[model samples]
Target: MRKILTLVIIATLTLGYSSLNAQNYKFGHINSQELLNAMPDKDSAEAKIKKYAESLQEQIEQLQVEFNKKYQDYLQKRNTFTDAIREMKEKELSDMQQRAQEYQQVAEQDYQRFQAETMKPVIDKADAAIKKVAKENGFTYIFDTSSGVLLYFSDKSIDITPLVKKELGIKE
Candidate 1:
């Protein structure tokens, strides 16, 4: 019975010591949005996406203008046309409208794909910088405060944003 009590006491002490050791973890937080915005690559990627979107908008606008002109011409000339000719003209206009709509949808999808492709490298670079900073600084866990999901973190936790930005060679 004495040996059993000694064993239990040893086990309790070991568990208490392990729990205390676990409390020594180094936690950190960073505003990822701030990091991303500071990246030079992000600015260029955004500019590329904006330009691509504008080109698509211009194409859609041109199509709309062409459609409007054809529709107006049809309205002005419809009374002079035979029934069969009018039907053919109407079908042609309908086909043109359908093609324009299809092109707009395709352009929208292309824009999304382009934006994703353009941003992927920039995002990867930022993630790598953050990971490197965290590892070098002995951070056990780095939470993104920019996501707004962290309800509360003590001020005792380190903010590693500047460290990560420095790792990426980003100024200020």
Candidate 2:
């Protein structure tokens, strides 16, 4: 009986170990920044952002020029103006300055929002492609190498960039 129990225990342990060794995990890595840069839509989106920023800058420049002219005029004619006119002119300049500042803040926020809106589709497409490649290739983990946080990934880690690009229908 003792010999039979020992054989049973030994067989059970072997089977358990074999089952554990049968499981497999695959890892993949990709430079997502490179992928985003390679996307054509990103270039057009950035161009649009640049043009919008330039337009905002131009409007701000116009405001500054107007403020400067008013300031110079006030300085030249202050001696001839009554107290009420002087106060009114100062208040007007102050109001313009305040409005310009407010507009700048709002412009910055609008720019951020526009950038996110423009980039969302491109990002979403890239993400979907990555996921599709991962699932299709049986990858257990796909890490982004662009952010610089990953300290050590062995050469054994498969590069999935090309696969993802192909999934996205991207050339080169």
Best model per TM-score? 1
**Tens-digit lDDT string for candidate 1 (20-123):** 98898999999999999999999999999999999999999999999999999999999999999999999999999999999999999999999999999999
Looking at candidate 2, the ten consecutive residues that score lowest on lDDT are 17-26
For residue 117, what is the lDDT in candidate 1?
A: 99
Residue-level error in angstroms, candidate 2, position 69 = 1.7
The CA lDDT at 81 in model 1 is 98
Candidate 1 regions off by >4 Å? Answer: 1-11
lDDT of 2 by residue, 1-172 (tens): 9999999999999999888865577889999999999898899989998998899889889989999999999999999999999999999999999999998899899989988998899899899999999999999999999989999998878999999888877899
Q: How many backbone clashes does candidate 2 have?
A: 0
Candidate 2 TM-score, true structure as reference: 0.85
